[model samples]
Target: MNRAAQAVVMFLLGGAVLRITWTDVYLRYVKQGLRPFLIAAGLLLVVAAAMTLVYEVRDIVRHRGHPAHDDGHGHGRSGQLVGWLLLLPALALLAITPPALGADTAARSGSALATVGESETAFSPLPPGDPVKLTLIEYGYRAVFDGGRTLRGRQVQLTGFIATGPDGRPILARIMLACCAADGIPIKIGLRGDVPDLAPDTWVRATGQWIPHTVKDPVNDSEIPYLEVAAWLKIDPPANQYD
Candidate 1:
C-alpha cells in the first residue's frame, strides 16, 4: 500500500480496537483479565499510524507537485486497492459489530461440559443464601465433575440465553471463554419438566436445583450436568456475555 493509504488503514484498525476496548464491548469476546493487553495494543497501533502520517506529510512537502513514481513500492493504483481491504474489519467492528456468541454457536459445539481432573476436585458447600447466583460455567463445572455433590439440595440461580438441545428441546445455555470469542465453550443447565418452552437466544434467569442426571452430550457421548429449573423469567441479555 502507499504510505498514505497504509497510514489511514492503520489508524482505522487501531481506532476500531480502541473503540471496543475502551467500552464494555470487548467483554463480549474475551475475558476481563485481557483488558490491559487490548488497550496497549490499540494504543501502540494508533501511535504508529500517527507517526506514518507525519512521514507522509514530510515526503509530500519535499517533492511538491511531483508525486513519486510507481516504483513497485505501493505508489501504484493496485497498492491502493489492496490497502482498502484493511478497512473491512474496522468498518465491521465500528458500524456492524456482531452480537455475542449464542445458540447457533452452542449447537455447533458438541460438548457442554469441560472439566480438568474433575474427579479430583474436592466439593464445597453452596454459598449461604436462599438462591445462590452463579454463572452457567461455574454450575456446570461443579455439577458435572463433582457429581453434583456441591449442588445437591441447593437452590441456584443461573442466567443465559436459551438454546435447543439435539432433540429440539429447550436448554439453558451459555458460552464460556478461555481467551476470546474463538475459544468459547458452551455450557448448559436443563430446565425442569414444568418450565415452559422458550425461543432461542431468549435471555433469562432460572432459579433451580441440580437434578443429577447423566446428560450425555447428544452429538457426542460426553457427560454433562443439568439443573432442575424451578422458576424462570425472561430478562435482557447482560452487558457482558462471556464468563
Candidate 2:
C-alpha cells in the first residue's frame, strides 16, 4: 500500500486495539496481563499514522504545480488492493466483537489435556463457610490432582457454561488461558446426578458436593474428578467467561 493508506490502516487497527483494551472489551479475547502490550501497540500505530500523514502532505506541497494523471485518485490498483486487505481486519473488529468462548469451543476441544508434571499443592482450608465460591479451574485442579482432599463434604458453587465432551457426555466447562483466547485451555468438571437436559452453552451456577471418583484422564494419563450436582440455577452469561 501507499504510505498514506498503510498509515491509515495501522492507525485504525491500533486505535481499535487501544479502545478495546482501555475498556473491558478486550477481556473477552485475551488474558488481563496483556493490557500494557495492547496500549503500546495502539500508540505505535497512531504515531505511524501521524508520520505518514506529515510525509504525504509534504510530498504534495513539493509537487504543487504538477499536472494531474489519468488515474485521478492518485493511487494505483495495487495500493487500493493493499488498503482493502488491511481494512479487512479493522472492519471485522468493528463489525463483530466476539464473546469469550463457550460451548462451541468446549465441545470442539473437550479432551485437551492441561498437562503439569507432578507438583503437589497443600491448599489452605476454604474460608469458614459452606458453599464456598470457587473459580471453575481452581475447583478442577483441587479435585483431580489433590484427590478431592480439600473439597470433600463441603458445599461449593461454580458458574460456567454447559458443554459436552467428545463422547457427548455433558459437563460444566470453563476456558483457562495463560495469555489470550488463542492459548485457551479447557477445564471441565463432569456433572452427574440430576443434571437437567439443558441446551449447550447454557450458563448456570452449579451447587454441588464433590463425590470423588478416580477416573483416568486418558489424554494426560492422570486422574480427574466429577461433581455430584445438588442444584442448577439458570443464569445469564457472565461478563467474564474464563477462569
Candidate 3:
C-alpha cells in the first residue's frame, strides 16, 4: 500500500494486538497476551507513522494540482496539513502507555478459556506427615483417580486462586491454559479442612495437613492444618496451572 495507507494499517494492527493480548478475546479470537511487548512495538509504530505522514504530505502536495494560490498567496498545503492532523490520535496512542491487563471476568466470560476433567489417576506414594508442595493442577490430577490414593491421609500444602462459591465461601481455584494465559481453564477445590484468609486471585502458600475422603468429582479432600496459617502472600499467577 501507499505511505498513508500503510501507516494506517500498521497503527490499527498494533491496536488490535493490544486488545487481543490484554482481553479474553485472545481465547475466542486469538491466543496469547500481547500486552507485555507492546510498549516497544508502539514506539516503532509511532516513528513509522511519522515518517509515512511526511512522505504522504509531500506526495499529495506534488500530485494534487489544486489551488496553489488563492488570492495569489494561499496554497493547497493547508489541506495536506489538515490530513496529517487527523492522524494525531494514532500518534498519541503510540506514545501513551495503555492500562494493565484486567483479571478474568467469570460472569461475562464464564469460567476460563479451558476446563478440567475428572481424570481417574492417582498420585504416587507420598509419605505421611510430609510438607508436600502441590499446585492446583497436581491436585486435580490426583483427584482424577480416587482423589489421590497414595497420598491419602498425608499432610500436604496447596496453592492457587480463591474462587467464591454460591454460599459465599472461598474455594481453592486455579486455571489450566491450553496455550497462553488467555485460554485457561478454572479448577476449584472446596476448602474443606483449612484455608487462608485471602482475596480472589490472591496467591498464598498453605502449610497444613491433608485428609482424603471419597467425594464427587475431584473425589479426594484434605484436612489442612486450619489453625496454623503459615504465610498468606499475594503473587502473580504461575506460568503453568496444570502439571
lDDT of 1 by residue, 1-243 (tens): 667878888889889989998888888778889999988988998999999999999988999998656565446667668779889998887987678999998788866574476354766788898699998878877877777888888889889999987667788888888899899878867666556477899998899888867567766556666677788889988888777
How would the candidate models be sorted by lDDT, starting from the highest? 1, 2, 3
What TM-score does structure 2 among the candidates reach? 0.85
Candidate 2, residues 38-104, lDDT tens digits: the string is 8998899899899999999899899899985675667677767866697788777766788788887
For every candidate in turn, the CA RMSD to the true structure comes to: 2.3, 3.5, 8.6
Residue-level error in angstroms, candidate 3, position 207:
2.5
Ten contiguous residues minimizing lDDT sum, candidate 1: 111-120
Whichever of 1 and 2 has more lDDT, that candidate is 1
* Candidate 3 ranges with C-alpha deviation above 4 Å: 1-9, 12-51, 54-58, 64-119, 122-130, 180-182, 197-202, 214-243
Rank candidates, TM-score, best first. Answer: 1, 2, 3
TM per candidate comes to 0.89, 0.85, 0.50
Clashing pairs in 3: 26-30, 119-144, 120-144, 121-145, 176-185, 211-223
- Residue 42 of model 1, lDDT score: 87
Kindly give the stretch of ten consecutive residues in candidate 3 with the minimal lDDT sum. Answer: 218-227
Query: Which digits, one per residue and each the tens of the lDDT, describe model 3 over residues 1-243?
Result: 346866875666556546544544334322335335654575577577778888899978897977544455443666556656656665554454432222243212333312244455445676545677776556545544444565555556777666663345665665555555445455555565445566666665565543453223222222211112333455675533332
